[model samples]
Target chain A: MMLKSKVSIVKGLSYQGGLPMLSWVLHRISGIGIILFVGMHVAASFFVHVVGTDSNIPDLLNVFYESWGFQLFIYFCAIFHALNGLRIIVLDLWPQALQYQREMTWLEWLIFIPIYGMGVFFILRNAFAGG
Target chain B: MSARSTLRPRSVQPAWSFEYIMWFFTRVSGLTMYLLALSGVVGAFILGARTQVDLQTLLRWMFFPNRFHVEPYLDDAAFWVTAWWQIMQILIVFFAVSHGFNGLRVVIEDYVGRSFWRPLLRSVVFLLWLAMLVIAVFVILQA
Candidate 1:
């Protein structure tokens, strides 16, 4: 009897699960990621300002962009944060669509994987090849 | 740990105090980005007022990269130049995520009388930004 009911719960459209909460938590977590990357970018600019452009500042900045590891890290960060950003922006603007939130969250994640993978390929071709 | 200057109990930490410790990098990073943007704005204002475009000034402002408006408080140049960028990079990621998504999370938590569809829809938008932030950062860093 218990097993039969458990299967029905998942099969039913009304079923509640851990995903809503998980999606909520992760979405917020990614916002910080975007801010962090921007922060580093800002700090680097400051240094360039102080020293002037005659120095190795541009070269060093290029070095980071050229790095394969850094390239992948930044690319994924952009993809996840941007996709998730779209979802949260919609959620905040409209508060009545709670029902679709679960389904939308899953769709966003699915879309994110392929989008981010494509991003990785592009960065590797443009930035990593030189390094 | 010094006593917090607040009405809370000795055991109770102020909101900024605890969040500062755990999310130190992101907070600092946000500050950095804010300063950077401020600098750009200021530089642009100065340039906009100029009669003839100054080549030297333009290049300085353009390629100067991050606006170091906050660096005045940082005192440590070496740290800011190298280690700090990476630190800010990691932390900014965290803080932006937290601040941006807080709205959606709150709405979901308070979904009693609230028009549920709008906030949920907005949440989708925020999540997309989050995905872009993630995918872009990782791809850039890893590539």
Candidate 2:
């Protein structure tokens, strides 16, 4: 574990800039995002017991997807969270990639762009179609 | 520690109070988010189960508030149930954003002297959270 502890990321890269920092921060962030999302899912499940088959269910669902504001937020969150998670996993496995870190970092953005587009498409589809 | 990490008052003069407060807040928030996520998954299962069963036979006179005559969507049960879950899942988004923000903050600060470089990312995180929170509040109120 000591070797793991000594595993520093700065060794791979020669320069300091915002891009690498963003990825590093995002890697941690996406992890935390997933954790929190899972937690809220559990808590909200409890409400189902009380309001099981409640009439408000449809309206609530409609309200959520009916609006553009929530939809856009969700799309962005999903895209960034997922893309950043992948970046972290890759970095952890290949420390030497720091040498070509910029290329890899841009790759993350490349993947994210499409994912964001997909999210927007679905969110808009659901939002406009229903309400 | 770089000026970026050191820029925070805590790095300059560490104290039990600030650390303890931050620790407590994070754990409490983390646990809440964890449980919330769990419940949602379970809720999905529960709703799924209802779909397979004969809700018409079982739910008759059950006194559920949302009960009605029309088939809400995929049968009377599924549409209602899935929608209900979706409404609640918004909170999960909030928790997720918070958790992600906290983790990002640490990672950005981990670099030896990169505090100066982190402000922009931190600002982005804060703004996203604020916007998400505002939307969540509005949606929940509308619900």
Q: Best-fitting candidate, measured by TM-score?
A: 2
lDDT of 1 by residue, B16-85 (tens): 7643543454334445545543454465454351433333333233323222422343334233244333
On residues A1-131, what C-alpha lDDT tens digit does candidate 1 reach at each position?
A: 11223345347655555666666555555545544454455444434544456767656765765477775776566566556656755664454444478888888889988877876776567654672
The local distance difference test score of model 2 is: 0.52
Computed on C-alpha atoms, the DockQ of candidate 2 is 0.10
Candidate 2 deviant stretches above 4 angstroms: A1-16, A25-40, A50-67, B1-143
Residue B70 error, candidate 1, Å? 26
Question: Mind giving the per-residue lDDT tens digits that candidate 2 earns over B1-143?
Answer: 35434334452453678546555555555556546655644553455535543333222112111222113334545444345544554555565556555665655455524445567777876786676565544444334
Task: Give the docking tier of candidate 1.
Answer: incorrect
Error of 2 at B83 (Å): 23
